[model samples]
Target: MQGSFCDNIVRSSTKDAMPDSLGNYLIPTSYSRIVARELGLQERELPRLLEGTGLPPHVLLAGDESRISGQQQLQVMTNARRISNDPAFGLRLGSQLTPRSHGPIGYLALSSPDLLTALKSLRDFLPIRIPFAQVDLHEQGQSMACDLTILLPAPTTQLRMLVECFALVIQSLVESFLGRELREASIHFEYDRPAYGDRYEKYIHSELHFAQPASRVVLPAHLLTEANPEGDANSYAAARDMCAALLEQVPVTALSMTDRVKRFLLAQPAGSVNEENVARSLYISRRTLARRLQAEGSSYRRIREDMMAEMAAVQLRQGQLSVESIAVLLGYHDSANFRRAFRRWYGCSPQSFRDGVKPE
Candidate 1:
């Protein structure tokens, strides 16, 4: 009843770069399932894949969806990387992902008339498959560069695997589209060459470059115009529409630290939300909470101040609560201090701001 605006913000953006523990599963279970199969986990051994994520075994086994959290999927990948003997686990995982495994996005790509159209679908809807991953297509002389970036935070090992897996997945799709291996394409990785660098040369037919500013692939510009022999106009239209709908549906699994903090804070009961409370709720130390927020150009105090101001405005605008009551709701211990803060924020008294009366 106190946080009307906060309630609406939480409800509307539950899936937007925020934690979704109580909402419908936003992350597709495909990646987790793949890790299970890759590990050759027997029915009883499946728990190894789900170690710290608090997800049940059936969730991964139960078809493609029945969704899981991003943390759950990341946990499984972490387990797989630790368990697998192969140092190139990410590349190996990428090679194993079939087009069918990509779901509607794969269907859209396979059905696209030309490579450019297919790549465009990736650029526009990669988030549908991997919420934190984004692809930007650009022209670099005779080559088209598809720059890939992962925006969300995760464990260093898990993050590295996700990047390698996604880069290879995209490369595999490009090869699938051409119906041939790419001898001239070059892949630029954001990270330095790994200990098992030879595995990349062995698996990736493309010319490989590492230690670059970002992860990207450079290919002959003419390849984008080449027709897909398996292209189907009707299927492409249907799958493209489906990708659009799916992307619209979940709002993407946002692993952004700031967004997660904001959503969690807004959803908590008014007086119970604060820096200590947030750090505990988010499973991070106070120092970590402060550091992550600072990286995003925000601090816990800054976020709380902004939210309090907005809450004050909303309550005042509704005229449902007196200025004193609104101040209490926004965590102010005294109305006089609240009035001073409000005046500083709006350059006028709260009531006048609420009444839309400007300072003369």
Candidate 2:
């Protein structure tokens, strides 16, 4: 792969980002080599799937080559999937397969009332689990859309299969949740059309766009408002609250809109921050900010409140600072207002949050 192209595919810190969590699930390069050997293919033919590129397959397997172009990596996956006949082979091979992996996201998506809601739930919940991939839900003409952007520091040698598997899993889960396939949606890829594009079309039963602006799956806008057969309003509310609390506690450990907002706040130590301020810093609009957060099943107000609560809780627990000082740290006008907000946040007064809870 060209150096520039490889740079685009991999993440900034490749060594730290490898998915080793899927213990027995990882089908390493050695495993692939074994499969190829069983099929009577020479080691030289291993990289043949990447016909135009002179790089060896071990570069991807051994972590020697830091990057691979998204296009080239996709091409290799398409060829490998075709030859291997395992639709889930790539994810099963690449990921750290574990019970705790991917978390409440699958449940939230399934429990949502409509396709839009399900997608929004995924957008909100995915960050707590898979930080490497950012998924967006947007309105497209009369339809709705989902964009899946993967952030990896190393060449995703099996990204094609990973994308296909994610698309399949999302589609299947949507159909299972709504009790029907997406009737008026389409799938799009940022990479070039591959050899198995037709198969993708047949599986999705929708138009497939290649080399698109981004990697996304589009659905009709009406799907957003559809009544969910499995809807449980109370449960969803509780889940949302729990997630909000989680976001406040450890913002940097995860990739989330909430976490991003917290990071932004930490970077700007002084002042009252709001959506417009955050949007300006991010180079996006207030309207776009609202829309994106809505897709994530949260609002700027919610994240802001969470940040304040967390800051207050931390200061209070330290017990070294007075209530007035803590209030100022959180950009409050006075202790009374900060106390009210604290009570609302933890169902107890600021004094209680300080004195009652044990350190985490």
Candidate 3:
């Protein structure tokens, strides 16, 4: 496996963070795709990524996305490192997890109005992507810091993989967002530098600082306000709405009467999924709908806003209409009113939301 790994590193060489187990958060198994592609693994060799994790190779290669438990993911990474015998293998993987690899989150980064907003979105929404990741943003006198607090119950090997991967992943993402290398930035790791990796200049753009209190990346404060050229009102709004809705929709299954109503509302057109229609769809009288929702500690109006926020996000992500057009479609007479309502729902201006949604 090590020989194949060395050869593959030379052949493929290119690829794709982590934290601890917080409340049984599962990781996407599609990471196997990154391993396979980056390691130049042949079709039959794809099983190498999941080898001893009790997860099958086909699941690793599954066209649809699948998730595995934290323990299972650690086992998989353990196998990856064992096979590679390269201390910096995780950094190699991080190089491939470019900003755009994150789907809606990628849209948020690319369409942000400025670098600071993009970084915040990355900070705010990353938990939705990687649940155990805790990124603390701080402003020092001359620079900004992104600190990752790891709470993983894993061996040093797995922890190394996690930290190294996160370091380079952030480096790649910020560079992509800023459209330049982060020469004035640096990454600090809590662990000592491995003998095999002294600089790791290829994957991480910033100067490397090891043996720190926490693993973090710091950049000059002046760079934070730089505007992104790709930003626009439409794309940013849509991307933001999509990300916010995705966050709201986590735990994916509807466990409450309120949740079930949200699911029902989301399945139908936005404007038509009103109180009466919702009651009808649930096969209940309006009064019963009211009573059950009240018992569930929710109400029709609150649930409707959730539905509308999600609908607006979906439309914004699709990039087929202007924010004003979407507002009207959702029955808002004034676009400014829609903007205010959207902010209340998602915590950003309607145009600001589009800054997170990249225009298609």
Report lDDT per candidate: 0.68, 0.55, 0.67
Q: Which ten residues in a row have the lowest lDDT in candidate 3?
A: 1-10
| Lowest summed lDDT window (length 10), candidate 1 | 242-251
Q: In model 1, which runs have C-alpha deviations exceeding 4 angstroms?
A: 1-25, 62-64, 235-360
In lDDT terms, which candidate is top? 1
TM-score of each: 0.60, 0.41, 0.61
Model 1 lDDT tens row, 251-275: 2243466655655554333445578
Pairs with steric clashes in candidate 1: 17-254
Q: Candidates sorted by TM-score, descending order?
A: 3, 1, 2
lDDT of 3 by residue, 9-121 (tens): 23322221333345455666556556666665654665677777787665543222456666777777777777777767878777878776554456667677788888887
Clash-forming residue pairs, model 2: 10-152, 10-153, 10-154, 11-152, 11-153, 11-154, 21-96, 22-96, 22-97
Q: How many clashes does each candidate structure show, in the order listed?
A: 1, 9, 15
lDDT of 3 at 333: 75
Error of 2 at 194 (Å): 1.3
